[model samples]
Target: MKKTEKIITNKIKINDRFWGRYLEVVRNHVIPYQWDALNDCLPDASPSHAIENFRIAAGESSDDYYGMVFQDSDLAKWLEAVSYSLENEPNPELEKIADEVIALFGRAQGEDGYLNTYYMVKEPNNRWTNIRDNHELYCAGHLIEAAVAYYQATGKKQFLDIMCKYADYIDSVFGPEEDKLKGYPGHQEIELALVKLYDVTGKEKYLDLSKYFIDERGKQPHYFDIEKKKRNDTKPFWFNDDYAYHQAHKSVREQKEAVGHAVRATYMYTAMTDLAVKTKDESLKKACEELWNNVTQKQMYITGGIGSMEFGEAFSFNYDLPNDLSYTETCASIALVFWANRMLQLDANNKYADVMELALYNGTISGMDLDGKKFFYVNPLEVQPEACEKRKDKKHVKSVRQKWFGCACCPPNLARLIASIGHYIYSQKEKEVFVHLYMGNETTVQIANNNVKLTQQTNYPWDGNVSMIVTPEREESFTVAFRIPGWAKGTVMKLNGEIIDHIPLIKNGYVYINRKWQENDHIELSFPMVVERIQSNPQVRHNVGKVALQRGPVVYCLEQVDNGENLHGLILPRNAELKANYNPDLLEGVVSITGDAERIDQTNWNDSLYRPVEDKTTSVQMKAIPYYAWCNRESGEMIVWVNEKR
Candidate 1:
């Protein structure tokens, strides 16, 4: 049978082993930090509502409805994370933390089904009417996802019931029913949440409701217009009334450029793709493709950052790629990963995977410090210290990450994405289940009526050699898919120590090895992560003479902490001596770098328009590290891109 045919009948599983490690990381690294910040912010600071969401999913919720704080998508994602954590495997410490949090949520939730502490305590009278601005639906959407994830992980019904009520409340408030308000979310999260609900509950209504919002968006009686009219405020959301992109004067499909709130745009696109795939809607599919093209081909940064200008922290026109001032929010990149993955499921394509890979290695990971406390909401490639310090607009776009912002979403989101990363690894088309990511972990997915375990052992990104021990329940010949990355210069794949018919994997996209498999089958894949100097697209005018550090999917950067002086001015000479070694005592385990730290005579500051330039070039050993590793030790200078001054 064709490999695709077999997967049509089989269910793939992401094993308990991989998720166990993820839960520990989240419990140890993420939760404690967030909790500490919360304790400092809210005395009643507990991840309670959020905990209940996870607890209900873990089949541990004592109550049907989780409390107020847990009612939203933030809580929903947290729940989803917990559900994933304890799904086939259980972690005691993680569960204990979840219990503490759930009890808090139970206390915070009201009896009337009203939730959300922010509004419950802060603005009780301001519900439903402010649908466009408030995150009620967004929060509900997250709850729905958490419910589904919890149910899937532990077969729990309480959280699902709670979120179902929340979803129903949302559906009742904003849809075309009698006494319903004609509006949609200002932030487009509910649509994706509904998809999750439908998948978990098999409720067609949820799917229909999700499509309704997506279809209703950008039509007359637009959500924002109505919201403005209701509030008697003509001013635009985010204070950008003059900007056409913010209002989206053109149809979403016609709106090629990414415009308005970076997170909102990505969430909307994610919903669009979800609706498109669920219904196979042609127009929606076309719109999705068009928008994808617009973002990838035009607005995206070499590091895969989307938003350029800080005014909106959103999309601008083509070739407006500026290095000095960028508002490429980390969540946008995470959302990009979500949208791209959804697109991949709809149609087997390389572009989606390519973007997904790019965003994962650079933009998404760039959100947090290597130790995990510090975070960067906006990731900009180029920064001049004067521009950073003197420019108020640019000042908001931080050159270094900070510990927990009040508008914090990216950090937890990053943790969750990294933890649940196995979902992105293997995708099935018929009998052929494709392995797009090469991380060391054991995964089990049902393929062709039997459980197929992929014992993938590899030190990837740093090293390209991957070996997968394919263990199937029964003797079967099918297809095993491997993503050939768009960045791979050369890749080789082998099965059972015998080279398959060589499909020269250009860019290392998916290389499918279709054949019969037996017990103890071995597959070896290798892609040399050659340290290479990369030149950006010529249209990206700022990076014309500059070179980016790259090995595998990661784009490395040099910080002034390790190597000081005129970092932005320093140019890495072509064929400059390159050597890489691991510093175990460094931030978050092993870090690799090339090019010795070179120093130059300090520029003398004179009270003249132009002072006599120093003619001395002082040579010292220089080194580079991952961008995420900066700002941990001291407030030293950081450079994502360095020039090789000849």
Candidate 2:
């Protein structure tokens, strides 16, 4: 497969009608609140103690490691988000704090260049002893990502050199060489991060290290098992004997199913795709293709959520999607986005972007609240307040977003992803520019031997009209491929107020418009936005007789706040006339759907669980808000798929 180059986030400035406000909130509100959380200034939030851990490790304070083994990642991820934000909106104060933090990081490094606070402060001798359960390498992955972002955003090499030292140290410790330890991370993040590190520095060693980790994972005589027996620690840890939990059931090349923790598996798959495209490894590419099909075909929800059960935050089986008991961790969906986007880079396929957009608009954004303060770690398709309260298994499914979590991975992950969304919109390969996502943004692309600035305007996920104005330094010939989203039916593309009726160059999921561009050359796209009814595969037992409402990329849900109680007693008629209406005062001004439906009256039914008797039904109107907007109002029953009236 041929790979396309991407226009990095730094070159893109967002003025999106839909995502612009969200990005602003992330920069202004979320970043500050999270910084406060890291410093333990937020009352009632989980104590991060992240900054204190760094202080101790840097010898600035007399204390020990105060949080989880991976507590350092919170600050690392925050710095990454700050780096992206700094590229667009420069803040001198934030840059000063970041420089101070980088200096502390330099001081915190040991002589050998290892930089984990937990082991450095607490288990100095036990470094790399329990890589299976501990997150030393996982934390290093986030730090490396932070370093790359910081270097790119600010052109500062202080933190980059620190991470490089750490990576060099890791390269020396673990590899295929006889002198190195045959070990990989229990969590799968560093694999992808190493690829990013390699890309930035053009370091062959880092690329070889990432491939070594990917190739060595889940091989015979399993290194994780060998490492576990070597430790001989009686203390219980979150280690599963089933190697599938970490996606090590077999070597990655031999693995076909998406198993284990959804986030870990997706991260590993993402790295594998990266290596596959970079190295042109057909075997690895085939495995990725099969796994991708397995995930989207059977395991995924209509909201693009994965990880069915919370047991291991893992997949159960094919066609085993459950609604209320789902453990669709927000991070997992974000990882899905990561994996899907990489797949698109390998080959410009609309199928990949379809899932990416689905998750971004619904499953992924649903992780955070509209105010950008509270966040949901687990996003379930259906929510029952009583179930979330009383049932132990359903505890992961929260009716409302929480301030913080003990693990606290999803919030920072969401923040970083949201802050760096510009990278996902456009990709460049030589003279070809692919517009994969639609949003209002102005970006400069280095293509056709010229820096071409393009401005996009759209109110996407609600409306389907898009306008693009192209400005070039001089008249240049280039091909601009606009992604026709799979959901966009009957789409029309126009150039300079004239309809494009000639033979259109359509491939994968994009329409290629090739021409010599001039300043202010305009183009327009029209994708009709209408209420859509979606259904699941028959094998999905929970949604066997149901239909879901959708408009463009946004999935709509019937919440108790809008539909009243006894939500299950209502049914959307098969021939119901659904209408799309935009209300400015509703849920941050979302386009809502209204339709005619039947409400069953159970007042005359006996008090038995099941009765073979007729029940009165009344014709009524039902309203549904976007799935991401659910639980924002008064907590009540909420469902994505509703029964179709007979």
Give the candidate number with the greatest lDDT: 2
Model 2 alpha-carbon miss at residue 377, Å:
0.6
Per-candidate TM equals 0.86, 0.97
lDDT string for model 1 (7-93, tens) is: 121122433332334446665676566555443443433333443343443445554433443234554455566656565357777
lDDT of 2 by residue, 1-646 (tens): 3443654566789988678888898889999999999988989989899999989988999976788999999999999989988886789998998999899999999988999999988898999888987899999999999999999999999999999999999999999889989999999999999999988898989989999999988887988767777888655446455778888878898887888899999999999999998888989999999999999998999898999989999998999999999999999999999999999878889999999999999999899998889999999988888889999988888888899988889898999889888989988778888888999999887765688999999988778999999999999999998888888888888899998853357888788888999999998999889888898899999998898988998998999888888788888988899999889888888999998999987676568788876857899899999998887778789999898975
lDDT of prediction 1: 0.68
Candidate 2 residue spans exceeding 4 A from truth: 1-4, 233-240, 502-504, 606-608
**Model 2 misses residue 28 by how many Å?**
1.1
RMSD of each: 5.1, 1.7
Model 1 residue 403 lDDT score? 72
